[model samples]
Target: MLKSNFARFAAVGLAAAALVSLGATAANAAPVPTEGPLYVYDGNGILIPTAGHVFDWNDNISASLSATDMAAPFHCSADATDSYTFLAPQGQELTRSAWQAYAPNGFTAEGSKDLLAFTLSPYQQTNGTQGVAKVNGGKWSLGLACTKDNGVNYASSGVWWLPVTVEAGTGKFTADPVGDPVVGSPATIDLEATTVPVAPDVDGPLSLNVPVGAKATLGAAALVNGLSTSTGKLGEFTVTDERALSKKGWTLTSSVADFVNGTNTIDKKQLGIKPIVVSGTAVAAAAQVAGSATGSAPFAELAPLAAVGTTKLNADLTFVAPKDSVVGTYTSKLTLTLASK
Candidate 1:
């Protein structure tokens, strides 16, 4: 239910519109509610052209731009070719990307956190069992920017963005030949089908056997040689997918709370983790994150698999406490989450 607002528009990497700064205020002030795909927002007395858009996933979502038409929105000139592109913010889990090409440009709106949402529905898999599918589809983004000069000598740019949900499609066709069609006269048949993208299911109601009472003695405070480390025995994680017909994949995520002992504290980022699949039918280990991640880097503590099957995941934990720290026993909680992609 939260919205992430973008900052001034700039298509530096997407296309050749880097000079088109949306933050360039015009010499004259314009009133708000300016009609068109773009609108003038009277930020105090500085007018700014702003816009928003939405698109569907798995489809060739695009928009045509003419210098003239684009100029109208931002009150610029149509003297040059319009610049445009669909920007995919880096570090975002695109899953099944639909962009025609990779867009290297991205921007972080103030206070914007990478947010994602999905709607699931119950359905029968091809194997004749119950399964879930994404109804609204996954989220992504599209970026647009264009600018021109006509004596205005000022950059007028606008942005179009919204939460886009893309869907995958499977098409099949059959030829209903009419009485043995000849080479010149071929039979014509039509085929059409629409279905939901099968959602992944977790084989859980299980638990990771994380070791209890993990300890990391500070290098200076270690009794038997200054070796400081704590290993966790997160119980064995098992992932079993009986639906061989489903193509959905999943990821196991690990996040932790800050280690704290009264007033003394250790950021969760200090805890290193490396998840690996010791035994599995079809599963791959995620890259070792080495204890570093933010909301934008969700994989710092994660286990990712490509194939569908039963797999057991485990992690190597190294809790490192810095020197000059309190001597109290700090406690922290570790959490593991399984999600479908």
Candidate 2:
């Protein structure tokens, strides 16, 4: 019995060992084949998530897609052929008129290809004082066609609003006379006009000169022996006394004639000598009368009373005295007057 029991025990131990070995082999064996069938396809039609194809967080798109051809907006251009205007007084010329171009945005500008081709119109509406006209401030506009390299050609039109101003030439007028007394005298008056481009806030004054005791002739110069000259004899004599006159807000300055000394003589034959003809009758005072003395007198009174037999006659007389009398005493007064012209 003991032997049979020991043999059964060994058999049981062998069975248990076999079971442990089987469990170990099963744990180490290869996994069973997957149930799905294998196949291949081009990645072209595959659907992709939008997030997968995004360039960045801001721009999301499918990774498998692309945008079609796109284009920019079309451009247009326009311009004014002429831009500047010039004005001038009648019988004047313009010095300069230039035009320039500018771009405010994406457009580009270049110098005109044909500068000489620009045209200018003749001056119109010419009055006695002013003239008006138009001139071509040369400029051009280019079209929106693509550049030679197939890039968008950014061309723009430009305009120039040039400032126009009037240019006047020198002008002239006749001169008018200014001051004097009434005497046969010579004087010069100046003729002038405001120069072109007159300075700011300045007005020019015209002036003239006349003899101390003479009047000026207006319009035309005085004629001497049919020849025109500034000097002319007065219609009446000027008073020996100084005088003044005013006209047109101007003063006529004048001077009186000066008298110094005198002598007297008488002889019908001696006074009537050739080139020395004695003026008819004279009084003792006649020889002494000098400044602006008018009228005639007989010589008999001018001669001193003669002795009953002696023919020689002599006379003492008082002469009109000059204000400042001396060796070279010459006294005169200046008067100021105005012009009417």
Candidate 3:
């Protein structure tokens, strides 16, 4: 009986050992260790996420300065402030000192072709989004110089307007991966919603000097031909809107009161002087030039909004002085005003 009991006990112990070996094998056969989000490297790269995923850096930000800011002849500065709420998931630990910088490829003057850059600091965050990262100090300050040609001041030089945009490829951002392998679209710098100020400029002065001895009914071509003799060539007044369609359209208002010499004034009707816009065989009324633009008459519209070059318009006065008028130096202010429409 004792021998039989020992055999049963040994057999039970052997079965228990076999079960333990099977459990070990099963544990070893399990799948290999998989990395978790804690140490993940997403292929999409890092994201400077804005509200609702709308990357409208241009639309969300605005740059403004007093006309006085750009009124100086040599240099001037204006303050520009913009606020946008952004969320940086992978950048939770990022501090205000850990700022990001971008090199805008086309934010340069049109003539000098000088490029510009700006920096953004993380100031506030909500949930995962920051509140306000003021681009203050001197970063938002603009250094501009007044340009003049032949006693005429130029407001814009093409380099300051037309808002150069960037999206994914036009610009880049700085980054640092502290913990896990963080990735982002650092190249995706959107400018579709942003717009910069443009200084519209008009060049060429219209000066007509015809003696009373000259014949009546002076056509545009004749006036230009005669004036060309003294003022090189009678060129059209070139209108340039570097801001283009980024803002509202502009207008060219030409109005003349009457010829005046000291206290003497030439009656408007007697002068018979009207600015006429003649293109080929199409002749339009005075005040209105180029095409029959929308809004009001006599206002030229800025079409082909994407165009960067200048548009030229030829204007001349139809002199019909009375044959019996008194002889004296008659002068009138041919007022040409350019304003945003």
Best by TM-score: 1
Q: What is the lDDT of residue 2 in candidate 1?
A: 18
Superior candidate under TM-score, 2 versus 3: 3
lDDT of 3 by residue, 85-135 (tens): 122222211111122221112223434322222122222222222222222
lDDT of 2 by residue, 1-341 (tens): 11110000000000111101111221111111111111111133332221112111111111111112111122223321222222222111111111111111222234321111111111211211122122231111111111111111211221111112212221111111112211322334566787532334442332333334554221333343443322212222111111112112211222223322233221111111001112322212233233323312231221222111111122222223233333332222223232222
Poorest lDDT segment (10 consecutive residues) of candidate 3:
5-14
Residue-by-residue lDDT tens digits, candidate 1, 221-250: 233234345656444556665444444555
Those runs of model 1 whose alpha carbons end farther than 4 Å from true positions after fitting are 1-227, 281-307
Note the Cα lDDT for every prediction shown.
Answer: 0.36, 0.20, 0.27
Better of 1 and 2 by TM-score: 1
**In lDDT terms, how accurate is model 1?**
0.36
TM-score of 1: 0.31
Provide the lowest-lDDT 10-residue window in model 1.
Answer: 116-125
Q: Could you give the candidate ranking by TM-score, starting with the highest?
A: 1, 3, 2
